[model samples]
Target: MFDVVVVGAGPAGSMAAKTCAERGLKVLLIEKRQEIGTPVRCAEGISKKGLQRFVEIDRRWISAEVIGAKIYSPDGTEVTMAEEMAGNEVGFVLERKIFDRYLARLAAKAGAEVIVKTTFIGFERVGNALRVKLKRMGEDWEVETKLLIGADGVESRVGRIAGIIKTLKKSEIESCAQYLMSGLDIDENYTYFYLGNDLAPGGYAWIFPKGNGCANVGIGVLPSIAKANAKFYLDRFVEKLEIRGKIVELVSGAVPVYGEVATAVADNIMLAGDAAYHSDPITGGGIANALSAGYHAGIVASEAFEKKDFSANFLRRYDELWKADFGWKLRRNKRLQEFFLKLDDETLNSLARSIAGKNIREMSIEAIIAELIKKNPSIIELLKSFLSP
Candidate 1:
């Protein structure tokens, strides 16, 4: 019987397996895809500081190093913010295909057994272990595991089967559509953001450079308020861009824009990554949080094994670790997202104009919130905590 069984081979799963195996646990990591990281579905941008906190990012996995970003108003007014001003000195656009495989390799080297083209069908409790049903390359099999980690994506089958997470509303999920295209005349060092209700409805559009005149142009929309689906808005935005090359790849996915699940721990099961709704509500970014959660969950799970206890009470440590690290911050960001959803194009344009001449280095979140509150004091009650010192 494996000590831990991790579903999915994304960053979270690989990190969980690696961490557990390094602690002397027998870990099993599985992926449904024939090949890991095929057809990437992310914006692939990570803050330089955030990435450094976990791993020394290998140069092979970096597609571009960005120094700053530009936020555009509905009327084409631009508010340039340096990376330092945003508190992230630089950002790296990753080659996710290479990075995902590199992480999987790390897990394998740490003694975790890795399986590909394997799908987790269901699980049943058998005494103190779990009987995991899996389909491998058209064959069905089962494995016994003391603990299970759900590192699956937003639409997590494992989470549903384990009954750890509830069904999500469309409003709580951000639908995304993106295309990787080359021969673009964009500033390779600056990620561009476009904001307007007509542009992306409740969300926004982005252009993250991938070097070599290539970039990932994408749009996210809140289904609750979107006039059309994400693809329609993305197609409309793409038509207006001055892209010169053919679209090389199309990527589409949904991210849970909520905080962690109500209960990420259930007896011998735990959910991590998107399955636990760890993505940032304001930006739909989850890689950093996913890695952090997986690492902590592994630690907690290992300790549980050492104590010979796998009950929900013993696994509460995992929930505590993630909440202390990121759960609180994610909840605050969700409030910010709610405020953003209420903004109209005129208010967004006014905000851009208000910050046009400010030194980007001095532009902090608090300052921006203060400026916004000046224009709309009615929101003071909602933003008091975020703006407080």
Candidate 2:
């Protein structure tokens, strides 16, 4: 019997498997895709400080080093900030294919069993253990483990089986489409954002540089508000840009910007990463939170084994750890998201103009909101509505 079975080979699963195995637990990490990290789902951006917190600098996985960011309002007003001042999605553009494999390799080296092309079907509670079902190459098999970690992506079946999360409303999802394009003229040292209801409708469009005239151009939209699909908006935005580009790759997926769930732990089970809805409400970024939650899940699971307990009470340590890590940030972003959703194109333009000349050199999401509360007192009523009970 394995100590734990992690369902997914993304950053969360790999980190959890590695930490557990390093603590001398028998761990099994499974990925449904034929290869790990194929069909990259995100914009592949993360904070420089957060990445360095967990692993050494790896040039092989870095596609570009960002220096700052630019935010363009609907009226074409631009607000620029240094990299450190922007949200968590501003530091680096990554080669996710290489980066994900490297993370899985860390798990393998730490003595966790790694399997690819395997699909986790479900799990059934059996005494103090659980029986995990998987299909490999059209064949069925089962494994017994003390606990299960749902590191799967959005709409995770494991989370459903564990009863740790609920189905998300379309409004809570950010439907995104991205294309890797080359032969574009850009600053190459900065990331860019375009914000306007007419442009993205409850979301934003982004241009993250990937160096050498290449970039990941993408758009996210709320299904409830967007007039068309994410691909439609993405195409419209890309075509309007003066700098023509050639597309080399196309990828699309959904992000769970639904904020946090009631809990991420159940008896003999826990959910991490997107399965637990850890993505940022405003930025749609989750890599840093995924890795942090996965590490905490591993630690809590290991401790449960040492104490010979697998109850919900014990697994909740995972929730506590992750909450202390970034729970406040998620709460604050949800308020920001709600407040922005009420603004029209003109209000956004005015807000941008107000901050265009301000020195937000060390601003983050919190700082940006503070500046708004300070300068754009016009929207104070709207911001206050979300802030109070």
Candidate 3:
């Protein structure tokens, strides 16, 4: 019997397996794809601050180093913000194919066994253990595990089979589509975010530079408000930009906009990364949170295995750890997302104009809320909910 079986070989699964194996636990990492990290679906942009805390980002994994950001209003008014003002490197557009493989190597080095082209089917509880079923090459095999970690992405079936709520409300998910294009003339060192209802309702469009005049241009909108297909909207925006470029790659996906899962841990199962809905509600960023949750879940699962207790009470440690790290911030961000959805294009443009000369990243949450309340007293009630203990 394996000490732990992690489903999915993404950042979260690899991190979980590595942590467990490093602590002397036998771990099994499974990947459904024959090869890892193919058909990359992410925007590949990550804030430099969070990456530093999770792993020592290898130099090769970085596709482009960003120094600042440009925010464009509805009517094309642009405001630039520097990394120094943001107190970080601003962001990094990663080469996910290499990065995901590197993380799997870390798990292997830590004494975890990895199986590719294996698809997890279901799980059966036997006495005090769980028997995980997987299909390899059209053949079925079962492995007994003391603990199970769900690191599967957005449409996680592992969490669902484990009896965790994986359903996302229409308003709580962002439908996104992106295109990688070459011959695009853009600032190679700065990421751009376009905000407005007409551009992307309840969300924003982004241009994250890759390298050599290449970039991942994408748009995200709340599924509830998206009247047409996400790809349709993305195409319209790209056309409007008058980008003279050749499309190199295309990616379509959904990002969970919910905070931490209500129950991240069950009897002998735990959910990490997107499986746990750890993406930021406002920005729809999950890479950092995924790694964080995976790390915490790994440690807690190891402790639980040693104690031979996999009950909800024993697994509560993972919940506590994640909450301590991200709970408050996510809740606050969710409130901001709600507020953003209600704003019209004119209001967003006016707000952008107001904050044009100001350093937005340096502004405190309370200060921003106070200004919003001053401008629109109707938002005062919602702001109080986020500010109040």
Clashes of each: 0, 0, 0
lDDT of 3 by residue, 207-273 (tens): 9899999999999988788788788888989999887788999999899998656778888999998
Best TM-score among the predictions, by candidate number: 2
Inter-residue clash pairs, candidate 2: none
Q: lDDT of all predictions, in order shown?
A: 0.86, 0.88, 0.84
Cα displacement (Å) at residue 144, model 3: 0.2
Clashes of 1: 0
TM-score of each: 0.94, 0.96, 0.94
lDDT of 1 by residue, 1-389 (tens): 89999999998888888999999999999999989988688999877876787777899999998887777888888877674543344778899999999999999999999999999999999998899999999999899999999998888898888888887898999999999998888888888888889989888899999999999999999999898989999999888765566799999989899865656898998888898999999878889888888898889889988999999889989989999998987877787877778778997888788777554642234455665666667667866755353
327: Cα error in model 3, Å:
2.6
| lDDT tens digits by residue: candidate 2, 255-358 | 98887677899999989999889999999999988889889999999999999999999888888888889876777677778888988999899999988976
lDDT of 3 at 300: 97
